[model samples]
Target: MKETTGFREKVVIITGASSGIGKAVSLQLASEGACVSLAARNAERLQEIAQECNQLGGSAIAIPTDIADQQQCRNLITKTVEKFGRIDMLVNNAGFTVVDKFEDLQTLELFQRVMNVNFNGAVQCTYFALPHLKNTHGRIVNISSLGGIVPFPGNASYAASKAAMTGFSDSLRLELQDDQVSVTMIYPGAVVTKFQEHRLDKDGQVRGSDGGSLYTEDMMTADECAEIIIEAAKQRKREVVMKPGKISRWIKLISPSLLDKIIIERVKKIIEREAQESK
Candidate 1:
């Protein structure tokens, strides 16, 4: 089916807009006629994206923001409103992951940082965008992950933050039903983004690494994930799970034990081997 291009004249806000799925969505929405507000910590990269959007004959602005700060999130929304007058859509796509078994590598400070950006960041942005979104009967797209639905031992903090987003979206969906503000949670399986390369290592430090067992460049592209997310948002869908082996979905439904056994044997092996090799 041909996807609908229903974003014309819409004022959309996208976090983590400098790259990855966020950049893909900003470009896609702008191409479809939305006035996109791109937010991130990188000013130079954001300007490049804004220029690309303008070249497509779409309105866009770069808003340098660190979503971990509530005031900055509010400022992003406020500045967006001042520029485009109303917000029609919000894409919460800014997040990173820290990979290690909870016991082997868990650190309070690291956990807090993950929650701050992955969970609190979205909360702050959503809190401010809700009013503007409600006014326009707009959409909120929270980019969660399959980890949110099913737990991965090495990704405890990441999964927990994403799970929080899912729970938040579910409750907000009910609350905003009367307000005409739709909350959609998207759980993407494995998209080709820079997410894994930028993961937090075991020493509670940020580092870049090459492709591993999962998160392959051969996996679905960021643009593909963005397209699905955009379509779901346009239709105001409640929940979306995109592109994984059928087992991933089944694990959420029936027989987590069976799935856990399979995942632990195979996926866990790869992660373990990768961790050993890295060390």
Candidate 2:
């Protein structure tokens, strides 16, 4: 992919940089000459990605961090500042989900865990990065989901957490308008990634391949999603809804009942298929 010149020499911190969209974004930014700080729970993977970024013609550092922990989140920011001096952008992309009905066993735990990582983690990182971002007139690119706006079944926790993130980003954008710190929210539909393989099941166990085909043929690629995010950051776009057209968003806003009916039918089919597979 061709590198964008806008991010040249910028300092960027990306959480969940070990794999998927976060990893793709880090590589794209690095290729564009940005100094990337890679943060994730997997230290080894982070280091590997950092090495790759360094070879990509830009600087990078590996900061092993579990965003769910407040102290670790603080450390991530401190380490980034220590290395880069200031933050030009912060990508809060660290999150996970559980695939099961709302009434499934251990659903509460799943919900809490999802919230801690998806919502609380982002909040903590943003709180620490704000001061530096304000200094650089920086940007915050949050990787939210389409589920946040139009939720589907079997992933209540994921949808709720993303919805909360969208709300938080919107409010923060308003508050920071005068500060020159831009906030961009990305609502991705479905992307081809290992996210489903790592998601939790009804028993709070890592969902294996038995979960069946979670991604559809129409899903976006991680690199494609990353490119959109990089562009949004460069242009300071307020929001992006990843869809072929604006009809889905318009329908949701204009006739929510109709949208809900569509979602309900699709979800019912998925649930029924899962039930059949289990038997």
Candidate 3:
């Protein structure tokens, strides 16, 4: 028998499809002849990506959706099924973050806001798409982060939301095992995207485009990250953890104190930098 993951002409619904990993995934799958439903809060950007996907040889439709909204999540699934007839995959890639000292006296609304989009949003979409996915014996690929596995500083809410996803994906895989609906969890280290630029500040203000440039670099690109996710979904793998996250998980298991010390030092530098910026 030929080993075909049956990718061609497969129906895939990707959230956070406006940019970054989601956009990259949409284009790649489109090029491979998948019918992709692009969902995101940005209607204009979603349309642009959908157009690009269609031109790349895949059928594509843009459904402006906010996954955080349950009705919209339902609409995303409904619209995709209506257009494509069936769903082969659901990629939960939408994310939100807020950068601030955990002890800052700022309004703690950032936690709920981040959770709404990151965790709750993914949950909503997954729940709505599960029925469709079960019927097709499809796949659910979550775009988690390395921060979810190992402790990280500066973005508590984002990390917690991703951690929630890590746990959710694990349990969901077992629950859906009998249904033959595979769940693939991806823990990418750090992908170069508009993630930081869109992050909220301590006061819940947008950090703007310059936010990501100041923090870090030398990381994987969105296109590279998308490739890994696409392959993992195709294989229906249990989990795909990146190299750095794997090393950190090993270090944590071997010597938790050492990992704690490392995290503390990094947090110290982050605090010092924030102090300087605030002055």
Candidate 4:
């Protein structure tokens, strides 16, 4: 396992730092002595996390930001630079998803919203932070999802947005290769987090189902996911996949149809179980 001790005094800006994987990453990096900048729409939560970072013997500042807005994205980078003098790493982790099937919805607005937050937000932040990152020979860590690589049935918009993130990260990595900047894309499977509770439905309301049982027994914890990300950063790895075994990845690469069949069967089982329990 790669050690996070190398992060001492590093300046890392993490979007979506109010909770879930983002929050875990912030705390872990802070504990490793990184000066963390916590960004999220929730000011109170960000401040709370900032306090925790300080308590953990690392410096932190809270910057309330809605990454969906381009200006806010720019401001986040600007504030981080002003406070920390340079950006050693930029973690684009801000994103949300709607829980309904794409065909169950009529409007493109929700899809656009997902793209705005998941893809465009990262693009804008990267644009603003690139100069500072170039100066420091920094790193970019994008928190994409397994859904991006292997599409899910009820999460078309979310999957599409994450797929865009994966593509963007790949291209950006190649472009920055000669500049001493590294780009690492993370494809995480199901993780224990508050993400389900915060997701929206097709109508733009908070999802009605609790989604607790939707996770597999082997789901990773948010802290575990964070640790993987930190290790990737430390090693400047090109990519990381959080699947249980390498077979799944190989299946996708060699025969996507086979992968899709497996996913379909798994999803069918889940739906059947949910339907039976609803009775």
- Give lDDT tens digits, candidate 1, residues 157-219: 898999999888899989998888888889988888778777877786655656434454568
Error of 1 at 51 (Å): 0.8
Ranked by TM-score, the better of candidates 2 and 4 is 4
- How high is the lDDT of residue 235 in model 3? 83
Give the TM-score (vs. native) of candidate 1.
Answer: 0.92
Q: 1 or 3, which is superior by lDDT?
A: 3
Worst 10 residues of 2 by lDDT: 1-10
Global CA lDDT of candidate 4, please? 0.89
CA lDDT scores, all candidates in order: 0.86, 0.89, 0.88, 0.89
Q: On residues 1-279, what C-alpha lDDT tens digit does candidate 4 reach at each position?
A: 223338899999999999999999999999989999999999999999999999997899999999999899889998888999999999999888887888777798998999999999999989999999999888999999988878779899899999999889989988998888999999888888888778888888985456565666678999999999999988888889887435787998999899889989988998898787667
Q: TM-score each candidate.
A: 0.92, 0.93, 0.93, 0.94
What lDDT tens digits, residue by residue, belong to model 2 across residues 166-216? 889999999998998889999887888878778987788897776437677
- Candidate 1: how many backbone clashes? 0
lDDT of 4 at 50: 99
Report clashes for each candidate as comma-separated counts: 0, 0, 0, 0
Measured by C-alpha RMSD in angstroms, how accurate is candidate 3?
Answer: 2.5
What lDDT, from 0 to 1, does candidate 3 have? 0.88
**Could you give candidate 3's per-residue lDDT for residues 1-279 as a string of tens digits?**
112394789999999999999999999999999999999999999998999999999999999998888999999999999999999999999997887778882766778888898999999999999999999999999998888888577778988999999899999999998999999999998788888788887888887876665455677999999998998888888889996887788889999889889888977886687677767
Best by TM-score: 4
